[model samples]
Target: MLLIGGSVLVGVFTFIYARLVCTFICSLPPAVLARTVGVLTLFHIVLRELLLRFSPLQGERSTPARRAWLLSVVSWSLTGLLAIVIHVTRYPAFPAPSHLKFAVGYWALGGGLLAQVEYLLFERALPPTPTLSPEAQLRERLGRRLIEGYVIFTSVPVLVLMLTLQRFIYELHGDLRYLLEAVVLAAGFTGGALAVAIAYGRSLRRDSEQLLEAVRRVGGGDFQPGAVTSRPDELSLVAAGINEMAGGLQLRERIREAFGRFVSPQVATEFIEKYARHGKTAVLGGSRRNVVVLFSDLRDFTRLSESLEPEVLIEVLNGYFQEMVGAIQRHGGLVDKFIGDAVLAVFGLTEGQGDPAIAAVSASLEMRRRLEAYNARLAERGLHLNSGIGIHAGEAVAGYLGSTDRLEFTVIGHTVNVASRIEGQAREPRPPLLFSEEVARRLGDAFTVKEVDTVALKGVAGEMRLLTVEGEARSVRAA
Candidate 1:
């Protein structure tokens, strides 16, 4: 459809130019005029076919080249010029100035319109390409288009008018005054055209700067959309693209925040980063690594739930978890999951020099301190809560677990079972927090610990000794 439409359009313009020049301007015979139009139209159709057949274009970069249009226009204009040369060679009286002016104007206007229409038709026919980045689109160079348009529309017409006037003056044997007036008029026209071109160029430069600034802001983590112009050009498209990109980034951040509430923020961040780096192929799999697991549970939660209303029970539980989780996070621990009235957290998920056991112990102490502050606030409502925490450091399989539809990042091994049993032994008489012997081995002398008790934990061969953190050793204590 595009090829046929473009060919017919080009043929129609060729016939019109031929009729105007041969019949109206030169008064050629009808038979000769038909032959001239047929030859010119056929020549153009052949050239257009060749251009279509071999042209290589892909995606947006396939927009018709300026050189292709220029070649078509020049070929048609040269054919017309050759016909004129032949006519003048055969009939010496045909060398008229009026004829030359008409020919030049026809080639400049008519031929340009034909080439432009052909370009538009081809552009409409091309298949759409995927959206390219702003950087890629900027490489298309709109500046070059601006310069080419200025030369074609501004310079060419002015040059033709000046030449026509010069020829008329010479033919009439006019004085130097007429030539000077022509020169002045041409200069004025040139200057005005130049000023307009400069203003348009500056506007383009400003728009380009705005695009660059928007790209910089997006790169700097500002996901707010930028201002877009109403201009009907590639710059407008680029601005729209930037706005879309910003909106996508902003949505991703929102997803991350919501996801963090469902899981550890560190885990959520890692998930997002993997998605960004590996896209759909990214997977969360288990890894065996040494880590410290902490388990904390509100003591006598069943009796407390029976006493308070469901809403009040939930409120108290949320407040407790918030304080405990804050303490854990401050010590570089990840709150893995919440199990009803129990809270499970992991440290050393991200490997570092600091001992995960020390962080787990410090977090338990902070949890104890934060709990005191929380109970004071709860005293106004005639309510109090107590929680026991257990820490154990050992190798465990840590990663996403569960069915394909749903998964949770957590640690699983005998170490986790030992931590839970140790917390169970932390009754009223003993300290509210306890740790396994494995944790004590990692504690060194940094913290003062005492043998709490021995308890046979489930899935373990023998009884594991429990220890309670009293305080930091005097040598390492703050003054």
Candidate 2:
């Protein structure tokens, strides 16, 4: 539809131009002029169609200026040749004057200049290709600007040259009437050219403004996809790129949230930095580290689960875990895993500013405090809960373990086993918190602990001394 409309418009303009030149300037007969106009119009239409059909400036890498120049030269050259042939053949006896020939040549030159301007406008309206990189797209835009500048610069001089030639021809022939006609023609052509240039410039400006606004919105974190334009242009590619970038950021945020649920933020950050720097998996194999491990188990949880409704039991367990995990995390510990009603946490797995044993002891105290507060709340509802915690500090092998499809991060060795066994000794009538002799020594004067007894643990070489942490007294009668 667009091509047809442009062709029709170009044909009409060419016909009018041909008739005006033949009637006022060439002084050709009516029949000859009519035939000439018809020929010119037909040729104009055919050339326009061909140019549109096989446009060179349709791809990312095409030279738009060169294409426009070629179209202008061909269209105007054909017009000049056809006009001269028709005039000479129709009036063989009365040859056209030299001034008329010069006028025709100058007029054709002006038409060619106008055609170049129109070609430039058409190229500017074309949408940008998406496959081009940003740098390539920028270069293309700069090239277009240079072409538009060339057209404008050359257009002014050409129009002036045509007007100067017409004035000289009229003066040489001493025809005042023809000179007035020449002035009128020059004004009309100049006005029309200015109008076209102004309109094209305004349209280009509007599109540029829209693209700049869209870029600003994206920079400000507005991920809302812009309205897609029907034109296949550079602006559309920019909008698509912005939408893709925003989607990637949103996905990354969701993944970070999920990761935080399973590991401490510090550990997660360490893993990310390590992966970024080394490009190697950090959790695939065990590394021996002096880490403080803490294990907490709810006393008689099996009996509690049997007595309570399933929903109520789950609610209580979630609430208890939330409080306990909060304490562990607050003291720089990672909650490794939850087994039934027991939680295993590790400290000093990553770099820490303070002693890991001290952090573990502080976390255990906080857990007891939180548990007391939680029990007070449960007591109002005629329900209660109790838990025991055991802390141990030693070298342990910690890393990911499991099948290729599934993996679990945990610490293992004598340290972990001893911590779990110590938790088992925290039954009714005993202090709800116990630690190995190593943890007590590491605590120094930071905590008050008493030696409980020397007892041999399963799969251990000798009897190990255990100590019970003592501080703010609390009721553990429920255990």
Candidate 3:
């Protein structure tokens, strides 16, 4: 709108001045008006050419303020010269019968043009933007987007007003036309600059808000990937930062899930992230606690398998083990992997909990329940189901291991061996589950346990005191 208005004003004045030159001012002037117009045109073009060819816009060092100031000064100088040439050519008529007065007018107009450069000088005028602490500064820098709205907005209008005034003055003498052009150019440039600044500020503020939101989500551990898309150039840096943060969290999650299967969730979390480092490797071992250990073994497995096809026997064993593991996991127990048809589990090794003895007893009860359900279906086929479980409560060494070549996540100690020995003792008429006196002592106060005399375990020297928990009168406890 400003450009079109300025152009119309320039056009109207041009037509009027052309009429005056043809009929009244310089009569039959052939090259006079044309020459003046050509000179003025060459002058403004030269001003524009300075920016295009000589302006040192190299690399990231192209300071916009410096460019604007230099361009403004050159533009004002060219326009001032154009005005003076027209003034001296039409002397006596412009300054109203005085030479000194015309000189004063020319000097004032030139000074006014020079003053317009002040608008572009902003480093000394505006306040600095907000900054972050050293730790957060890297993240903030990654999210900023540099916009070009300022350059396009200011340059478009400044160029428009300058071009319009030059056109109007080309045809006319130094009069109201020159003053009107100055007003239009100054107002247009100033307004354009403010509008551009406001737009840039709004866009920057909005981008800043979004980046902050992304940072907050990362801190909160909400590591859903692909939260933000690319925005090209400077903005792409912000998206990269978000994805990088999300990736860190995703790695943590993978480690957690993998370790959780080996230990417990709480222990898994501490293992991957909280362990202290000396050089670079994690030095802190896994958290330790008194826990319930249970071991089970398939009785008559070799003979039972000898009667059936390998495929059917293997399938049956897999199905039975699957059911048993599910029962253990559902009751807050970790399956310490499978050793053929033998199953091993721990109750409180990785967790800070109640009592290991009670957990073992409760697990034994549930295991028997699951076994009966299984045997009921197989009873018709005479595929007798026989298994024994042993429970023990004691210390265990639970941590990541496996020389340096392979990493194995596990829990191992004397308690695991003791539990296996007890399981072996629960053969034939002796019952399906056996527990050590130490494990029974750790059970909840309500359990009715029968004391069984000490029996020598296979590896350990001392005979182990044992007990048998009959049923649900025992409240399960996990350490």
Candidate 4:
């Protein structure tokens, strides 16, 4: 229906153009014949549209080039057929010589104009098709659009004026004055067209540079919005799309930073990467895996908090946690969470070059060293503190846990509980760091470990052997 309506409008405009500009005497029969030919052309176009729409071979194969080629064929075919019919049937019998030249040129101009209008209508009727393959070069397509604009807006009108003046020259018996008027009109139109084209080209180049810079900034992790002013054309749509992409990236960055604050940055990064890789949210569940868990607590933290003001207590805790958490992360441990002045970290969830047991023990030793430095700083403030760390390696359930709205990635099981119980045993005569029999076994000859004692832990069925690191093995120390 759109095609039919648009065709009818084109025919009406063509009729008016011919009558006002051609000024040729025509019998009713030729007019009726031209209308009949137009009706036939419309029918042909409609038939082609219907066949293409319902063709079994029509899948997702339509392309812009194919559509443009098709529109060109249809438009020019109608133009040529109508011009041939008008010239062969009406012009040969016309009496005046000037009328023949005038009518033929006017008809050719009208036919060319008709072809342009039909091409536009056909293009609208057949919109671009979606395909999985990459499209053609956008730059090439935009360049083609600029050329089309020049032909339609500048070249077509100039041709029409030239034809009109040529007919006037023939009518006035080769008048030089009308020829001069033609030259002046051509010059003025040419200058205006050049100026318009230059302005349009400059605007297009500026917008294209802005879009490229926007993409470059986004790639460099700058997610700031771009300032690209574009006319209401393809450039405007491209600008809007780039702005939306930048906004989405900026939002994701904010989410990542917020999530990292709640959990370890390593865990947060893994969660996001998994989401992207699987193209869906991760399932809420846990898996049993062999891992090493480390637990550290400040001794007499409750008593110290009671002695200091709230602000001072918070400051001390923050300072202590910063040191301990940094030590854990340096050894590839995930800082699970903090309980009051206690820190819980896990290893082996993420694959790394070092063994999980060795990494946990190494982190514990580093925490001892960092705590001594922290103690020196506290001593300067007329205060001092101490902490105990326990490490254990065993099978535990590790994954995200909690309600859908509030989930936390952590480890939970007997392994974690045993590590916490073992930390309670670290006191005055013993080293501030201790580990279970399992951790010692995994360390093997990597570090010199001494059996501390066999102690019964709370809620455990039997007594468990604990060990403390004396020093690294000779080979490890040499390395």
Candidate 5:
């Protein structure tokens, strides 16, 4: 469409230019039908050659080379009309003496203008640079083509122009042909340089467009990487960069989905975001804030796992954790990590920093709610896995402390250890919910909690009091 539009604009100028040149050079008689017919026939032949360029049959065989050869033929054939065309007084008959001279010059001007147009069009069709190979090379051939056409046109015309200049102006006046040669040489150089510049620009545009399209296609989910060789110039670099980015995205997506398998959907999101924000996969050996911890285990998973095949065990485990994790995350918790048969989760942690204590309690209740639903579904499938949870709130440091090469983002220190011990000590007789004195103090009286006991857990300075939340787990404590 652009090329066509450009051509239409060019035609408008060509018409105006042709009219001006015709007015001065060719004031032919109205009786001259033959001269008009001859000019029309020549143009029709040029148009025929132009149309042949689009033929699919000629594409694979040899169109460019043939086109070049045909161009040479057109120029030589016109050269043959030099003498006869000059003397054609009118079309069929000789009229006034002055009319013949005007007609010849006018016809030559028209032919020169037409040839220049064809030369430009043909040059535009070729590749811009010498280094280009077929369609793969992205050099704007137009400038190079124009340079080549000008070169071809200039080589023959320079000799003629020089001879004319010498004979009519310089030679007759006892002057030098060197002046005429110099002028001709300068014009040739200028035309060739223009051709080169146009071709170069055209090449750049073509290459850049193709590269941009490739990148956009990949962004649009084409996903078919590894076939990028068309990237010419900076485009190649861009494609390479995009391929690297896609690789990273694919890796993140893999990790994102994996979290769901080992943990619940809720936990997975927080865990993923937390790890990504801090630039670590998991953490260990640190302190955490006042938090609630949940541990879920299969009551008879050992026996069941022993009986089941490897695939069956994994399938059951994955299904079980997916439900549990989803439940925990819905209440705003993060999955710390998953051991072989147990899952560890931290609630009221990073995601709930402003009010970690309250958020932990909410998450625990939601976890229980999700577990109830999971048990019902498991009942239908004839599978059973049970879980125990422990909640405690206290000051602790959470950070990235893992292997140098492969890091894990996690929370450690006193709160994590205490939360774990509370889980191990939990019993059906005592209470399913346990919180530290610290957690109780932070929570105040929002929840109706009881001081369960003060038991000396391993590696602690003194026995820590544990509380159990009974009812009304409201967010804010009453005065």
Candidate 6:
């Protein structure tokens, strides 16, 4: 609409100027001038519409090189036809027909130059072309160069034709003014084209720098989405994709936080590593591993719960479990599960450390020391509590268990059951820590332990020997 309105205003101004001030130079009547302006305006509009329909600048079709070539040919043909029409038409008062022909040629040259600039702008704004292959990238670069070359090559011929006509005019009239005017006009057009090219190059360089900085931030694990430009162009799409990727990483970090709360850190890390390496199938199977199982239970917890208020009991139990779990974790043990006031822990589930049975024994001795200190705090409130621990070493089938919907990674065998029974034996009038003969043999006199009576535990085929560590439950000075 702007183009059409501007053309109409120019045509009206030309009609008025030719009728009033330029009557000597332009002898054409007002009606003829008006008809000529209207025809030329309509021709310009039709030429532009045809160029848009066939040009790759519109982005409606593929094979941009072919389409661009076709548009260039049609544009030059139309320009030549317009120039010929101007040359053939007779204006009796006009000094020379070459002046009018030069004007037509100049208009066509300016339009072609402007069209090239517009096509470059449109190409820069287009979405990223897929250039995954080296050949595709080379082709894209070559195509851009070809288009630019075509624009420059086509413009040179038009300028040459216009200059040749001006030379003809000068030869007929013996004037030097036409040559000077042509030189000045060509210089102005060249300078303007250079300025436009430089501005476009600067803008492209700035956008590319911003994109590189954004990519660097993403690489450093900074997932905060940066401010993006509002332009509806290829750079805007790239910024949007980067922001989406950062959002996904933020969500993954949140999931990791929540997952850590549901399982031990060792289990969580192992599970994630295995899942990454072998997908979901990694956790489906089980293996028989030689591990040390430990179980601990608060003594007389049912009767004590009956005495204390629910809130107080909960507070006391939480504190006790926190200290015990910390001691176990410090000595390289994984707390498998907590059943009310009881804890089931295992060592050597994933990585085999040096003497897992010794580690379990060390953790148990630490727990006994922690409990004694805990009892002193209880003594302040006119309350007393004790705990029992049992340790055993054997081979157990350890892996993820339960249904697909809900799974648990744990050890399942007679060894775990025996550990539980040994914990029950702590209720007798003996040391509060006990272990099977298997664990005692593995220790090899690391600490003094006395063998207890051989008795058949439930579900066991024969009598199993047990041992209790001396001085484990003895009171020590609080530090």
lDDT scores in order: 0.72, 0.69, 0.60, 0.72, 0.57, 0.68
Distance (Å) between predicted and true CA of 109, model 6? 24
Which TM-score value belongs to model 1?
Answer: 0.64
lDDT of 3 by residue, 188-232 (tens): 767777666667655655555566667777778777634453345
As a whole number from 0 to 100, the lDDT of residue 203 in candidate 1 is: 76
Q: Write model 5 residue lDDT over 1-479, tens digit each, in one string.
A: 33333323333333343334333324544335345435544543554446555533233333353355355345434533432364453343543332333222223333333445554455567523443344432222332444445554544455435434543453246456666566777687866766665666566555555555656666786544543544355657776777787676667667878966654455466667777747874654555465566665555668888888899889878877777667666656787788887777776655534466666666666656677777787787687666666777665666556685665556676777878787666666666667677777876655677888889988778888888777543422321
Q: Which residue window of length 10 is worst by lDDT in model 4?
A: 132-141
Model 6, runs deviating above 4 Å: 1-221, 225-232, 272-285, 352-354, 444-453, 468-479
Highest lDDT model number: 1
Better model by lDDT: candidate 5 vs candidate 6: 6
Over 342-450, each residue of candidate 6 has an lDDT whose tens digit, in order, gives: 9999987856556788888888888987888888888988888788898889998888888766788788898999999988887677578889999989887676778
Worst 10 residues of 2 by lDDT: 470-479
The residue ranges of model 4 lying beyond 4 angstroms of the native Cα positions read 1-148, 156-184, 230-252, 270-284, 352-354, 456-463, 472-479
lDDT of 5 at 155: 48
lDDT of 4 by residue, 227-270 (tens): 47668777788888888888888887788889888899888888
Task: Give the clash count for each candidate.
Answer: 0, 3, 5, 0, 24, 0
Q: What's each prediction's TM-score?
A: 0.64, 0.55, 0.55, 0.63, 0.48, 0.55
